[model samples]
Target: MQQGSSAHAIVVLARGRARVERSLLSSDVLPLGYRGAGDMAGESALVGMESYTENVIAMEDCDVVRVPTSTATALLRDDPALMQALVSTVLQRQAEAEERLTSLLFRPVEGRVVEFLLQAMSRWGVPDARGTVISAPITHLEIAKAIGSTRETVTVTLGVLRREGLLATAGRKLIVVDRDALAMRK
Candidate 1:
């Protein structure tokens, strides 16, 4: 959905990935975070009277299930388990967002990029013979947006990481060659 629009329902990502971004101005858009399969977006609209604060853009073709606000409210009213799950999910997302903000405010570009990579690995990586591989087509532009940096900085930092034997790329996938070294930067 478009940023700043009134949202009527919660969009649950059933498959693929999406980025939640905030438009700073006409040309600047900062990515808040990402939602993969099983993640939900627009919960604030479903539970409260707030409009969507960010734009949710599909990183890849996605499958989503929309639960209207009325139905979500009704389900929450009638089902304790569903309500609990929703609360848990919202809290987790808030925590992640806070961490991102903290990193943006205090961390250097290298640290921020390393932290972002580590977090992405934990969320989406799969174990491989050599290292953990993020089996997604993530671009330098996306990484820059996510970490509040420029694409040039990300590109240079990635080259540094590659030289340090901390990262690699296989086709479109990102491989964490030395996860420990990467995590140490953060």
Candidate 2:
């Protein structure tokens, strides 16, 4: 959550057959695109950024961290460590958003998927008996949402990458077999 950034995000789940669209404007609690289980957004207000966003923030039975601008700024001056953590979190989130925007706008779908996998690999991968494995569970739908592609597209692309020996999904993780090849797509 960045200071002075007026965006509202709520972590909600699908109640019916409605698809959840991850945006700053949507109010319906449905899983449409990238709203995974326990997904959260940190912001104060919601402005018209995109139609995918919901105006109503449906945060029921969820922990909310609401920080007033004055309080936030005061904390920044009073607590250096807390200020650093908040700044780091906001910067990382901004970087990720920029990365996703760049991939979706300038690169091909394959490149976007590859870049996403590599980023995840760098973030969550750890050495194990089988190889460098991601310790977290990630779904194809999440990958699609991250890369601005359809779920089916992510599935097909993953299949193609797997067949080419560039990537693989083992257990709850996605593994990159050839980092060079994946980077070459960039």
Candidate 3:
């Protein structure tokens, strides 16, 4: 769902992950965060929103179950767990937004990119002898969206990061060469 159009249903991400974001008028993507399997999205409809608040782009192949707003609202009323889950999801999203805004105000593009990579590492990173490998597949454009930058800028910044020995890429994955050094980059 895009920013303005409400998806009048609850999206149960049953498989894979999705990038949650808002498409800016300038074509810059203000990414909120990610939604993984078992996470529920598009709950704004049940919360009295006129439309879906954010655009959810699949990070990979995904399978989803959509529950109509009316049904989901009824379930929300009868199911305390569901309500709690929704509240938690909303709160987490809010926190991510706040963090992004803070980064935008105080950090440069490189810092933002580094921070993004570090955060991703903590989320889906796999431990290996070389360093922590971010298992999730991400594209340069997605990185730009998350950091509110252009893809070309991201590409160049990544190159600089690599040259500095702070990061590396294998296949479609990003490997943090030195977590401590990379974290100190900002």
Worst lDDT 10-window in candidate 2: 10-19
* 6-107: candidate 3 lDDT, tens digit per residue: 668878899988988877788866777888889887877887898888888898899999999999989989999978988897888789889989998999
lDDT tens readout by residue for model 1, 165-184: 99988987889998998899
TM-score: model 1 vs. ground truth? 0.92
Compared with the true structure, all predictions reach lDDT values of 0.88, 0.58, 0.88
Better of 2 and 3 by lDDT: 3
Best by TM-score: 1
| Clash count list over all predictions | 0, 12, 2
TM-score of each: 0.92, 0.61, 0.86
Model 2 C-alpha lDDT per residue in residues 68-170, reported as the tens digit of each score: 4455556667999976775675577678777667767999888988887777677666765544675456778767766778889989988998898877777
Q: Over 4 Å off in model 2, which ranges?
A: 1-21, 24-75
Prediction 1 global C-alpha lDDT: 0.88
The regions of model 3 sitting more than 4 angstroms off are 2-6, 24-28
